[model samples]
Target: MSTAGSPSTVDAPRTAAGSAGSDAPAPPPAPRRRTGGVLWTELRRGVGPWCGGVVVVVCWVAMYSKTPQWQGRWTETTDMLRSVALLLCGPLAVAAGCWQGGRERRRSTGDLLASLARTPLRRALLAVAPAALWPPAGYLVAAAGCTLATWPYAGEGRPFLSHTAADAMALAALGVLGFVAGRLIHWRLTAPLLAAVTYVGLGIPAYSESPARWLSPAYQHTYFWDRPVWWFGPASMVWTAGLAGVALLGLAARRRVVALLPLTVACAAAVVLTHTGDGLWRPDPATARLVCDDGTPQVCVTAVDRKLLPSVSAALSGVNARLRGVPGAPDRWIDGPRTPSPGREQLEAAPGAIVRRVGEPVLLGPREAQLPSPFGLAERGRVSDPVLYANWAVSYLFSRNCPGSGVDTPAARRAAAVNDAVNQWLAPRPYAVPAPLPGDEVHLRRLHGMGPAESRAYLARYLAADLCRPDEVPVP
Candidate 1:
């Protein structure tokens, strides 16, 4: 065994394995370059990339136009992109697809393409790929850019990827339909007319308060904190993709009967979409939950907006300072849609009234952010005019369920003027405060002359009295 030039057991086994492995046949090389060449030809030669470029440009511009509204929030970002996909890119994609579809007919090459070895389905898919896929690619790019932009400022929650996927499917479906239309009709004006009709058609259903509006991918959403039902995105995808599949199959498949399956699926999806309606959305507990900052007269916003809490707190800092130790001040200023709503009549009243909001603020003199609606937030991201809005919010709190809602009589006017003066003296406006009607100057001077503790005491008494009855209001 140990004879001269004899191999050891380990070396012998290793050599044998190496020889065996080397003798085995190699795998076929992948046709990567060929596949790439075909794709390059399709993208480079066709109208697909051009259509995609148009989408990129339009979506980028639209997103930047309203950057402040959506940049700091994931929900806003996703919804904004969804709107762009449906309204602008969608129509353009349809027109482009139709134009692309007519190319083979214009060149008289339909017969040539058919004569090729590829199956009808393969040819159809290959031909339709450029038109249908490009718009979604453009959208994907825009979506990525938007998400990256929002990353720095976003407060909470991930982007609604399902919404984005559904939106892309919708664009592709529209493009597919337009392609089929072009194949059937060769008129040049047909594209423009389809675009116009489709645009109008999308809008017409929106005016009707029916569930059909929900079937459109462009339907509006009001709340950022609400999430779609788990199946909504999948349902939307199925509905659109199914319709597209049916259209493509009807146009190119050898057997037209194959279209029936997709047609049936689309119908079922459409039914589900129609029946669900607004019920598709529900409050996301994580986003809707209160996130409060620790401060006397604490400030709170939804957990989804936690990052913006500091800004909100800063906005109300001056007002909070005034109300922190006051005997009749609200313990916290809560901002959210879920803030308990006042009954109808009380909700409608004017400022300087004894209104109870979320308890213990007997005097509405100092509450802030009673209504944290997205409309208001969108108008001013991070509350652009915090001092002014803070002042306004405080004034709004005292407005509920009081006879002071109307200043019909001269006495009521005087009471309102005094209330205005007290509000101004408590929270100074950034700009010159307008003198209240019927002269609040005298009361304002009296309050300005008092020490801080004494002034707070007088404010307590004044707020307790019925400001609507001039006789009952304390002379500061």
Candidate 2:
């Protein structure tokens, strides 16, 4: 007989016969929230404090360190932006699941929840909602922060990251993926270890020339570079859809047979998509430029030069050889003008030779980046070319304030001046010329084709041949 004021059969008191509490507040009326109903509530309850803490900590550290500039620009470059997503989201997701998973148990409400035709899995899903939600939320926070940070640094008329929409979706998908993976393996020891492994694994490809970056569950947003994976947007929608199907089936399955198919197929597809063309596709150079046509933006290749192509090939070969000598060096590359290195002594000693670098960006303040030479020579040069008016300007500035590099004596300084004049006369405008033309004007062409050791020897030999004298070459 059902009584008007009695608890339902499933939710009845768990006593042997007549154990009763007269004033238990009616067991809070079954919580009014079902197993799946507390999604947003749990998400907010779980991730709110942690997100607040993260913002506070990141802001404090960044401010404390004075927020060092990256490559002479603000530290909001493309690679660092991607890192923001990874660092903030990946951990939040997994932690959210484990932290909130046992909420009911912690509050002594587990028995009541278990009686609602719910499995451990359904309740686990509720617990992990915060975990899933936090990563995406973190992405949004990071993206918004980056936009504000980069706004002041925009070039010409190009808006800051025209493809901001694509990037946001991509980050959200990756965060969701990470949160789900964490919820699945909620082991105390394994969760953190798995999170770390996933973090590193996803990062390797995103920074590489490979397409594996698109498949990574950690990339939330991408700059408007012409990477093929960006064409699919950041959400990795196909993969995320498949993952959702798997998660839903995983929730419903009661036995091994019922669970195997969707998961196995989904996982296999993921693996294939991630590793499809590991060593195959090569992105063309000149693809890094941003493009715009009637509000339709795309990443497109701009120009190609075949002149002195051998030098480009030789530079790449040298890089590969260096990587072979050093373990764990990144050997792959996207062919382009190399960005100038900062804060290091010149890696190559040939002063007249243009140092060619691929895939690096030209940054501000190149003069301060110069390193002290091994010899007591005070190395000095600011203009891109040291063989023309730029050379003369640098030479005049150096001789006035500092002794010339490689010039041990006053006579050597005089001789060094002679060398500079001849170099300027012969090369005319070394700074204005592109790398290909710059190297050819100063017999730096001979510097190529030779191996590193041989190239050093040739630079010495070329310096000895002074076809022109200082008195004959007038100061500009």
Candidate 3:
């Protein structure tokens, strides 16, 4: 009772050091680390995997459908598959990327993601990686499967790995670019708009005649028969990588304006690199050079068509037998200059060579009767008259000398009249004629019934007649 309030406090057990009113705060818990589980969850739920699967299925179907076209040639198979993949997958990947980027905005998660300790660039990369990577991965998987299937039937030349890689890179770059666009533009229609734009941009170059079309990743008009310079693959890869890099840099940069510098430089470099020369590709010597048969009446074909050499050689040898000793007759049989197609075969005359197509039907049927004497006319059952074909052949081989104008002209008409007259003299017999001829059947019969000696002399005079001077040409 002597010390009052101070004596009373000391007497107590002196409970904890802070009495009952302490106000100290506890330390905050540590931030969560970003993990692969998150990435997997995103990939599983996002459009990337589904889009990739769709792309794979589409490519498989397309490749299977065109099996007849590519089965004979390895380079063509790979090149065509790669081109189709690029054309279809590129647009789909871009659309997928756009949808992926727009998902966050649609969910209103921008603020939430930004508030996390992870940097925005890292967030973007993690989010966009699945879309950017999956399409190309799917494409490669499909390509591998296709190659394996076609391996047994494939023709000469190995697959062009460099071109395939370049195409894959371009597809990835498109996906990344689409992601960036989606992230920047918050419109609901951005995904479809971007996809349409990308498709049109890529497609225009394919149809365009300009050399600058090579700049487009989707502009793979060059076929397997030709090859670009060695530098083309690397240049394309660099250009596409640069495009993707610019998108990434732009997303990560603190200053938006500075991010454009790399993009601008890359674009200029790409233009220069892609514009390698006046043409996108040139003939490959290994494929284009003549591979000749080891025999008389030498038969030659491009290396790509070597598989058909045996049949081609046999066919041309028959034609050569009939053409022996003729002035300006072809000494060698070579593949004609024409676009490759199935069953659409043709032949043309060249200096010292008769250029014909492989697998042509002209080689089949009656050996002597179907042998095209000139301009590829034959005396098969389909012909209206054998004499008509013979006379046409003679005039075409000896007299006609105009370039193929592909239109009706005076020179062509006059040449036709001379052939008709010669045909009447040779065969007075008539079938289901398409039109009436100038001479009567009795007169034509008299001319046709002539003796062998007189007939041979008459034919000599007829063949020697000048078609240009129509009035002077002999008629029945």
Top candidate by TM-score: 1
Error of 2 at 291 (Å): 14
Expressed as tens digits, the lDDT of each residue in 263-284 for candidate 3 is 8767876787646543446566
Candidate 2 stretches with Cα past 4 Å from truth are: 1-37, 47-49, 52-78, 102-110, 117-124, 156-191, 203-214, 217-230, 234-237, 240-353, 357-476
In model 3, the Cα lDDT at residue 342 comes to 22
**Total colliding residue pairs, candidate 2:** 6
| C-alpha local distance difference test of each model | 0.76, 0.40, 0.62
- Which tens-of-lDDT digit does each residue in 1-476 have in candidate 2? 78889777866556424455543445455545554557767656755458535643553344323332211122124434445445544454444444444355457786887797767666656655555555555555655665455444332222224234433344344444444554455455644665576567766765765556556644433222223333333234445545654554464445536556656655665666566533212243343332221211111111222221222233224223332322222222222223322222334323322222221222213221111111111011111222332233222212211213334654444545444443443224445533332223343333334576754444334333332332322222
Residue-level error in angstroms, candidate 1, position 435: 10
**How do all the candidates rank in terms of lDDT, highest first?**
1, 3, 2
Lowest lDDT sum, 10 consecutive residues, model 3, at 373-382
Per-residue lDDT of model 1, residues 88-109, tens digit only? 7888878887987898999999
Count clashing residue pairs per candidate.
Answer: 2, 6, 0
- The stretch of ten residues in a row with the least summed lDDT in candidate 1 is 339-348
- What's the TM-score of each model vs. the native? 0.79, 0.46, 0.65
